[model samples]
Target: MATKKTSSKEAHHATLDGEDEDATHALELLAGKIGEPPRSSLQAILAGTTDADLVSVGKTILSSRIVTDAARIYRKAWDFYQEASDEQRKRLRGFSKPLLAVAVQQALALEQLDRKLAAKSTSAGVARAAHEKAAEAAQSRAIELRDQAYDALRDAAGRDEGLRAQVDAAFGTATTSETLARGLEQTAKLLRAWLGSDDEALTARLGLANLDDSYAKELATAAKDVRNAAANATNRPADGKVTQGALDRADGINVLIMGQILRAFEGAHGIDPTIPRLVPISTRRLFNRKTKKKAGEIQPPQNGNGPQPTGDGETLSDG
Candidate 1:
């Protein structure tokens, strides 16, 4: 019998490129042969394989045009995600700064409300005291009037016929005086009641207290929100080494502190034309003084005399 002939490499290559189905079959067969997947079996086959060089073939496939296109697309998508995340962080920081400011303002407002309530309470007390004093004065005046009216009525009761008409007038005056006294007493009672009324006092106090409480709650909520935002910002991965948002916040804080300091200095200085303006003065200069002392002296008389001089030609001096 004739010896069987094996297929040549070039014959296999031609068969592999003949049709789509044939190419796929050829690739699957090569994959089993080399234990690796093929890239475009038809192209590989047209190149004509001589040995099972799957490693070199795979490296070439990866460096080819198709993989390069896929890598470019992936890089574009990753950059877009990074940009979006950066924008989101910036927005969060922007919102957080104003929210923190609002929280501080709310706390200040609550303090102001407390002061106002205290002032109102003080005013109420002063008013009540004034009312009491007025009521007392009215009561004393009423008592005096009543006593005078009684005296007049008694005197008129002893008068003659024509004077009897005047006595009736005195009786009317006495009645008016008693009515005035009753009115004054009632006013005093009303004032005392007003000052001691628990309901009214409680209502006023509660109104102010409620306002303060509400403001405190708002401040607390805003502070919590600010803290949460700060935490999130810190926890999130930053795109750059330096955070711009943090720097902006630090600048804002510095400005605010400077403004407050200026305002405080202005307030401390009284407004007077003769008063010196605010200036930095050295402590040493503020306390420094110069002085002279006399140990002995020769005196000159008021009379115009040609001088009396020392024998040594030294003038008498004070030291």
Candidate 2:
């Protein structure tokens, strides 16, 4: 059977659709094995995971600070394994660098995906606020420049109806950005022409010689900010609405390696009991206790369960 071929653009968007049922199904499977932590041990993860759904587990493991702190855990953990001593390597039996590598890649993918989701919610709003602020500033600048020039003209053109008429035409009390911008341009042109006149006494009297350089540049930059920011207010990532299913699936994939990460430290207790701290954000602390090494031979756990999770550490509790 000949299958219809898709164009490159179609293929690209197909990848973006984020409705991969098979990948999401795997997340559903991974979410099931997040064994309940004891009442006094790693109880934090359990609270967030009471529902034990895919997105919930993903959200449980990842707090609000994914872009900066939570996301760095993956690469840092990978580095720990990269420099693992021979004994440390042996400790993490059944766990290979390839597996951690795969986990890190998945972690990176999920991190970027989450960031895109977050930006979609806030970008338009942020740009709108910024545009308003820039426009307000520009309006103020226009008002200031126009008023300063107007007052100069008003005082000089006292009893001179011609120049006073020009000032009236060039300056207005309206405060909108568009109104202010148009009035500012007219006021600047009149001031420049007045300053260039043969009347040195008038130019010096109004002190309008440098209006072209200082006033125009400052007002122009402010006006430009308003224009550019207005564009951003409209053009910001238009498709900010990410699907709930996509978010849930992303969250699932994010924490998919939780059980395997735990299994990696099954015998890694002796190597660094202080670390390989599971997930940097996890409340589950593994191999943090001081274990005994009998006669240089790594002693097994007293209960023989091996490398029990400890209570105290610098682990993240969402605290």
Candidate 3:
């Protein structure tokens, strides 16, 4: 008969069983505190890691869990610690540093990375909407100012017979020129010509109408913004999936914590059956929804400006 294979995970726990039970029990009693940690430490941690860092050292291990999975695993471990009595907490202090702290740091980093990626994914849409809104408002304002200038021209025509010829020459005798009277481009051209005209009367009429090149400039800016937004949207680098770099970092973090846990139990004895496998390896099994895969995926945000999670929102700092 072929001998049964003992998986690395099974072997790991089996090794844990050989460690000093008192140390394992002490570490198990109190968990790390929950909530967002300070930002400086987090920035250093985030910048300190990369995809290249998750290399295996001869021993193979599986670490495919997503960012949220890591966060929740830390949360669960912290939840267990939160239940400890003052005495149990004091017992935990005996160890120079509780092993779980290593896991918690990565949990926080993953939460931050998740948010950054989620924001990046939809940034293009947000910019497009903002630019479009500005363009719409600018066109409306330009048209309003154009109508005001037309009224100024009409009133000036009634007052000055000499100006009437210029008006007819520029616009028309009875009605304004359709080419010069319609659209944003037309309004801008009319404003520029009248504002910059060498004719003293034309310049005076513009002053009387309170029309200036400022409105034309605003329209120009809005038009440029729309074009820029469109280009940026096309070039944006996000696809609503966890970035490969982020996934690799997740693997690195898990491996770090797992090594710490394994070392913490080395040479000790007796199985503490209560120790959770800590986290799943890339499976969405953390929630135990078990109904179907992909159920945990989050819907895209309704608003362009605010950020939402890439995955399940059950964890607020969800990855």
Candidate 4:
């Protein structure tokens, strides 16, 4: 009677405990057969289950399904994230090369501009220095010339009386007109030689060679006038004679020649000469007309309206 004490529910519980190791294998086979669990299956299990063992089992199964679905969703999201990351990297790579090249080119352009600006600044500095040097040289030359002119004028004004007397005595006791004229000519020659010498720094400084055309023309005219005046002075009546005036005019002519020499120096040194207005050669011409032919050399006029020679041996006369 003790051996026959078999409770069915207790026996089932004992059997389930003994087959617990095979539960996972059995679930795998069942999951394959059912394809996948329905979304409401977990809810149905939660509602029906009341016993602690059954509820725990239902919860474990539902939790496993939820974990698997969550894992699947997480895997999909990871894949999408990877794909988006890959696309972003591709876009960044595509833009990076050109942007890097543009940055490099801009840096090079800025460097070149900086170099060019530095070179221009250096060249401008050199040009300015050169111009200043040239200006200083020109100014120095002007000062030297002014000093020389002042000295020459002062010396000429203070002619030595002893030298004049010695010169007069050397000519002879009786100073004839011909002897006096010869002596005067020799003195003029000496003066001309002194003034024309290159040793005179004033001549070089004054730029006499580059006289303006107007000034040169005026000097030439004045020279001609002086020569005419000198001739008139020599041939004038005793009362009409103006010896002092003639000498003064001659002196003026000499001064004009000296002025021309100064102008030439200025021209050589690239300076413009200060002079009177220029005169054209043809301005003072008395006759500038072209010659006309005489009547005897004129040609006779042709008479087209007088008569016409007709064709077919007939002549036509004007009405």
| The best candidate in terms of TM-score | 2
Local error of candidate 1 at residue 135 (angstroms): 1.6
Q: Candidate 2, residues 69-180: lDDT per residue as tens digits?
A: 2234444555677687877777776466555544544544554565566555456567678877765665565566667767767776656688789889988655455666
Off by over 4 Å in 2: 1-115, 173-175, 208-213, 216-222, 234-319
What is the lDDT for 49 in model 1? 27
TM-score, cand. 3: 0.35
Which run of 10 residues does model 3 get worst, by summed lDDT?
A: 55-64
Q: In candidate 1, residue 56 scores what lDDT?
A: 17
Q: Indicate the residue-level lDDT of 290 in model 4.
A: 23
After TM-score superposition, the amount by which residue 265's alpha carbon in candidate 3 deviates from its true location, in angstroms, is 9.3
| Overall local distance difference test of candidate 4 | 0.29
Q: Positional deviation of 187 in candidate 3, in angstroms?
A: 6.3
Once fitted onto the true fold, the runs of candidate 4 whose alpha carbons sit more than 4 angstroms away are: 1-95, 158-319
Q: List lDDT for all candidates, in order.
A: 0.30, 0.48, 0.42, 0.29
Per-candidate TM-scores read 0.24, 0.39, 0.35, 0.23
Candidate 1: worst-modelled 10 consecutive residues by lDDT? 280-289
RMSD of each: 43.6, 16.8, 15.6, 56.4
Pairs clashing within candidate 3: 18-268, 18-269, 19-268, 19-269, 20-268, 31-81, 64-282, 65-282
